[model samples]
Target: MNVAIIDYGSGNLRSAAKAFERAVAEAGLDIAVAVTSDPEAVRRADRVVLPGVGAFGDCIKGLNALSGMREAMEEAVHGAGRPFLGICVGMQLMASKGREHGEHRGLGWIDGEVVPITPADPALKVPHMGWNELDFTPGRHPLLDGLEPGAHAYFVHSYHFVCADPAQSLASVSYGEALTAVIGRGNMVGTQFHPEKSQATGLAVLTNFLRWKP
Candidate 1:
């Protein structure tokens, strides 16, 4: 199988690539993972992963700056129905709009908006760094195949995706208030945390993604 991790000049491509490599090896899958900005490469891949770091507007600008990369992603994931995964800021880009650094347009793959996390407690943090528990929603999602409700995932973000439809939320985390942790729609899934840095829990997520069908 071929997995293409889009490199639109925003994320830690090396780390994500290495994580997928380790996941594939452990899963015993014959998979070729490529980190590329080439639109055509992404279109041909069986699975697509978009990983991003930094601000939402900046990430979207980077992706749009790449000629045809955005179109390629839309065609591959939206038109062809390929399994797609987004990590951290990458996941936020799936929202219709983001409130970070003013309102910015996103991929609109999911019906939601990205907003800054406002913890109810005054002492709570904004980035929500470190590890947090993942509380999976009822029913099974292919991406959560080997993951349990209390599995902790590494997170480092100030903004989170607030899904418009409750059914789109696959899991959530509590930090003074409940926050969306995972969102899924059909073959597409996204995580607010950095799976590459989440250790075993993250690796299991990547492994499940490699084996996921829909």
Candidate 2:
């Protein structure tokens, strides 16, 4: 199988590519991983991953700048039903809208809004950096196969997705209050943390994604 990690000039592509490579090796699959901005490459991929960093509006702008990239993504992920994953700001882009610097539109794949994190305790900070535990939903999700409840993942973001339907949230993290950590709807899934930097827990997540059927 071929997996394409869409390079929209916003994220750490090398790190994410390497992690997927390791996942393929560990899973003993003959999958090919490519980091490309080419829409044709994405169209031919069996699985698609969107990884982004930086401001929400900026990431969206960069993605739109690429010729045919957005259309290719919609066709492959939305129309073709290919397994899809989005990480960090990539995940935020799935929301209906983002309230980062100003009001910004997103992919609207998920019915939600990206808003700044507000900790119930003032001592907690924004950008919610460092490691945090994942609290999976009761039935959990296929993308979280090998990961257990309380498994920690690396996070570094000022804003988080606030899903309109609570059922769309697959997992969450507690930072004074519960923050959305994982989201999934049908064949698409997203994570607010960097699986590449998350150690064993992260590796397992990547591995699971590589082997996931839907």
Candidate 3:
């Protein structure tokens, strides 16, 4: 099977690709992982991964600039029922709209909005960087397989997704307050943290994604 990591002029393509490769090796799967910009390649992939870093508006702009890329992704993930994973700003794009810098439209895969994080504690920072322990119900989602509550994952973001339906949230982390960490609905799943940079925990997530049927 082939897993396509779409390169939409955002995210660290090399690092993300390397992480997926490592996950494939650990899982002992003969899967092809390709970092592609071609819409056809993304549409044909068995699994599609969208990784992004930077402002929400800019990222969405870049994605829309690519002719038929969004449509291809929609067809593959929604129409074909393929498993789709989004990372960081890639995850934010799944919301109905993002209120970063200005109003920006999203893919609307999940019923949510991307808004700036406001820590409950006054001492906490805007960009919730470094490793944070995840808070999740065990066995709720396939992506969190083997990862119990308190499993650490790397994070670096100023904004977080707020699900209108809390059921869509797979997991969350405490950064002064509860912040959305993982989101999943049907065949789509997303992580606010960068799995590529989260070391062992991240690798486990990627491995689970590779073998995930839903």
Best by TM-score: 3
Steric overlap count per candidate: 0, 0, 0
- lDDT (Cα, tens digit) per residue for candidate 1, span 99-175: 99999999999999999999889999888999899998535687887777899999898988999998898999999
Worst 10 residues of 2 by lDDT: 137-146
Q: What is the lDDT of residue 62 in candidate 1?
A: 94
Q: TM-score for every candidate vs. truth?
A: 0.98, 0.98, 0.99
lDDT of each: 0.92, 0.92, 0.96
List of clashing residue pairs for candidate 1: none
Per-residue accuracy of model 2 over 113-202 as CA lDDT, tens digit each: 999998888899886999999998545787888677989899999999999999999999998889999999998999999999998988
Residues 82-200 of candidate 3 have per-residue lDDT tens digits of 99999999999999999999999999899989999998788998799999999999999999999989999999999999999999999999987899999999999999999999999
Give the clash count for model 3: 0
Clashing pairs in 2: none
Model 2's lDDT to the true fold? 0.92
In terms of lDDT, the best-performing candidate is 3
